[model samples]
Target: MNKTILSLTGAVLFATGAVVAQTMAQSTSESTVAPQEADAASVARGAKAWTNHCSRCHNLRSPSELNAELWDVSVQHMRVRANLPGAVADDIKAFLMSSATSTGVQYSTPGQGGASVASFAHLSPGDPLHGKEIYSQTCIACHGADGKGTISGVPDLTAAKGRLTKTDEVVLTNIIKGYQSEGSLMAMPPMGGNPDLTEQDIADVLAYLRKEYDIAPGTE
Candidate 1:
């Protein structure tokens, strides 16, 4: 009976060890992705939810409309009112915070001849790395991985003298509000169909495009 008891104890210990090892492996795998990437993924989800659900009721408020404190209170109140799941609400709030107008995100614009101007100098520079991640998630569908249009009539982002040559304000505004190229069959959706994308997201994406395609000011 002592041997039987020892055998059972060993079996239980082995099973427990296996479970712990598996759990640790899973956690390590999850930890490999940076928090920013995880957050960007969450923002993508929130963008979908915000567009599908929140817009159904009324016009969606701009992220710049409220401060972070106000957004927290508003999101909490709306979660209860709309019966939004806790996770969804949290994502929406995250979206709002990341894109908040007051966040002061900015990027520098380089002219063709190597002159650097502080474009949107009021805000901090957009993250090109983060922008690439967003582009992969959102823009890559229409704009190919190469920044060239994948579908028919889509603009080639690499054009030596094309859209990127336009002023920053014009480009940014066109994206925020959605624009249909004069000859295109369809208009590009606002925020590239990800409503949760912040102005920062757009800026990041623009920066990514400019850098990835080498389309700075006069160079375009």
Candidate 2:
């Protein structure tokens, strides 16, 4: 009887240990996946809000232009003017802060104005196929499916003396730092309002724009 009791106790303890270990493993997996999913969702929502509301006022500032703390303060101040809901503003803040620190791109201060031609020399030639994908996802909203301007102030990519008439360096820098066209009410936001865009992505998009729109160097 004594032996049976001891055996029963040992089995129960072993079972409990197995159960606890499994629970911990499950928790670990969930904790890892949940934050990644939540962060992506938050970034996406913030990108949408930024493109829709913030672009209405002026150019979209580059994430590299500000520190996280400054972004927080700026967003809070703009929240009132943009009439963004508290939750939406928070999401936008999350996106800005995340992008500001996350991208490995070298940052220049806003006071410096913009990037120089030599600064972008390391950029690889763009791949049109991949550029098409980026254009579809992000640029399509304002640039339209046909490379024409969807919004009133957006320059037509197909026009002879339009946006792409400039050299690749000029276009790339403008895209990275953001640009407001002369006499236009709205400005193109930095990184095309998508913080996830990389230098390669911008290159690809430029290649696609040239190919699809038949862009040629126009007389300055």
Candidate 3:
């Protein structure tokens, strides 16, 4: 009888081990497959949604033009502008925010160029809200939502060190006239090709960048 009991115990242990191993393998497979499936679905949905809802009124712009906060406002406002339902609009915003290369959070430091908001006098009193609108229409695709560029060679504004040193005048001038970096085939097209943006619109965007990026105010 004792031998019989021992044999039963051994069999139970073996069965338990097999079950655990099977579970582990299944778990591993799921972990790997789920993300890829979800990502694929998201991409398909984003592409379809963008084409149907976003392409008509606007062009595909860089995401870096505005930070996340600005993008949030811009997205909300654009819902109305695009005549999308609230739920659909929210989904589009989520997709864009998720898929776009911009950091969803605003940064507190200057980007690579060593420029900061302190240098700009005009940006001191600029309105981030208005700037958000301008950036959404113009800068969101390439620059991303966090002022970080998505393209490999494109400069990341959040990482710029030179931006910390720029004056408001310089920032304003760049926005108005556009810039062309060496070896860059694409210049920052004038107001990102939107001739409709007013000078005040540009100023508002500068202000938003200063405030979000934590640029110090210049002493008068």
Model 2 misplaced regions, further than 4 Å: 1-115, 217-220
Largest lDDT belongs to which candidate?
2
**TM-score-better candidate, 1 vs 3:** 1
| Alpha-carbon RMSD of each model | 13.7, 13.2, 16.6
Better model by lDDT, 1 or 2?
2
Q: What is the clash count of model 3?
A: 40
Candidate ranking under TM-score, highest first, comes to 2, 1, 3
Candidate 1, residue 26: Cα displacement in angstroms equals: 35
Better of 1 and 3 by lDDT: 1
Clashes of each: 7, 0, 40
In candidate 2, where is summed lDDT lowest over 10 consecutive residues? 102-111
Model 3 TM-score?
0.42
Can you tell me which runs of candidate 3 are displaced by over 4 Å? Answer: 1-124, 217-220
Highest TM-score among the candidates is held by which one?
2
Q: Model 2, range 91-172, lDDT digits (tens) per residue?
A: 7776677656534242342223544543567778889999998887767767778878665677788888877887777778
Model 1 segments more than 4 A misplaced: 1-122, 218-220
Q: Which ten residues in a row have the lowest lDDT in candidate 3?
A: 103-112
